[model samples]
Target: MTMESATDAAPLRTQTVAVKSSFYLAMRILEPARRDAMYAIYAFCRAVDDIADDEGDRAQRREALDQWRYDLDELYAGRIRPRSAFLAGPVRRFGLDRADFEAIIDGMAMDVEEDICAPDWEKLELYCDRVASAVGRLSVRAFGLVDDGAKELPTAPKLLAYHLGRALQLTNILRDLDEDAARGRLYLPREALEEAGVSNHAPHAVLANPALDQVCAPVMSRAREHFEQADLVMAGLSKNAVKAPYLMAAGYRSILDGLTARGFAPPRAPVRMSRRKLVGALLRHAFL
Candidate 1:
């Protein structure tokens, strides 16, 4: 549904408060309009991710995800409900399209299958497309680039969105390796690791082996490719459009740098960019 359909709905103060408190600091780097839009987008994503990662019986989690998908379908059909009382404004303000939100649902649904594998390259790409690329699409909308009237390559924004998504997804895979392993989730493909003489079956063996560096090198290299693509995508956007993504890219790249410094070892804690660094990047982008 378009932005015009929900102009009359009551303001989403409670929802906005939660989203702003949670995501607003980083989002504040964005153009005011885009920042407002991003609150909606992030809230929607955070909600879905919480369902997938939160404590619950596997079946219960799956049911919640399924219900989320149904809510997504209804939202698209203009039957919007205040699920969290925080989503209405940003969703309406940004005029986010239904498909972008649904793609998130599709990605979360993958978690319910209970068989996390080291996906082949093709499968991994598809997974990234849904989970990460979809987020990028939503970001494009937040950046107010929907229906960009271009004479050629109308998909530049979409490509940028996908690249951003892929880069972040890769960062997550690396950062969560230890935790994911304990939970029986392996994101790095078995074939690639095996080719480098690493074993997914014995994750600790691979971690202990010096050859694990070899295994991570290719994955990091590919992640860099996507990162470069995302950079190119940013180059084609308005300066305002580039700000939030630039910070996000820099944050992800910092994690990559940290991984490289650790000889590509998995992180013991969540990899995060300092607030100072994040704000510094935005200030540079804003004034430069």
Candidate 2:
């Protein structure tokens, strides 16, 4: 299907939300069909995420997520709901994996099951894979990095999804430490917390601990390593093929740098990308 047709057929709400997202520009730089496909995927993700983050009863939220899973099954079975019809074109055109979509829903279920406290390293990795890497898997397909008729993803793009997904997610976990704590969640791995002398696993208590920065250091280092690995993988690909990933990496790396400079001390100043820096990244990664 043509980009214009696909985009116009998309739910208006999805279009609006995708346009408003921070990654809009990065997505916009893509060829039309890919860009529209990405918008659809982003919309799907945002809808599930909203359900997970809703302040309603947990059972109701889980039910809502289940509804999405049902919708996805129907979608794959050649049925499409009005709200999700946007995905039909992309799913068929890009050969988007059903498992990746299901993984995203599973990740949302994790959030809804309970407020995650200090989870073990394994659980944390699983969460990152489901929530972030799964999305990246879908996105890489949308980005046209996956080969047509290929049964599996190419090694480089798959690795790109793995490393970049974890990098972006870990950066998010570090940047949102205080915000997540407010919501009674803490994503820092228990191993890191224990190693840093943060005996209290309570969200707010851990955030208040002076050792919080100590815990964040290893996570930050891991993020940097992932970013570096993603960079190395992207380095071998054509720039056009990896433009969106490059832009995303640059933007998040900027945020990581800002977080590093700001530190995790209490009364923490918000770390945000300045307009100038954002523009620079856009020019460098998207237009250059």
Instruction: Using lDDT, give the best candidate's number.
Output: 2
Q: In model 2, which runs have C-alpha deviations exceeding 4 angstroms?
A: 1-7, 286-288
How good is model 2 by TM-score? 0.94
Worst 10 residues of 2 by lDDT: 1-10
Give lDDT tens digits, candidate 1, residues 1-288: 332454333334333643544235556666655675676677677778778766568788888877877776666566765573344455555656667777787787776565466777887888788788888877777776664322222488878888888988887787667777666667787777879866544555555566667877778888899899988878877876677778888777877877777665443445555566666777788786
Segments of candidate 1 deviating more than 4 angstroms: 1-25, 148-153, 200-205, 265-271, 274-276
Tell me the lDDT of candidate 2.
0.87
TM-scores for candidates 1 onward, in order: 0.83, 0.94
lDDT of 2 by residue, 1-288 (tens): 332244455745566879977678778888888888888899999999999888789999999999999988778877677667788888878889989999999999999999988999899999999999999998898787887545699899899999999999999999888888888899999999999988989998988899989999989999999999999999988788888888888888988999999899898888865566667877776554
- Which residue pairs collide, candidate 1? 15-85, 15-86
- Per-residue error for 50 in candidate 2, Å, reads 0.6
Count of clashing pairs, candidate 1:
2
* Candidate 2 all-Cα RMSD: 2.4
RMSD, every candidate, angstroms: 3.7, 2.4
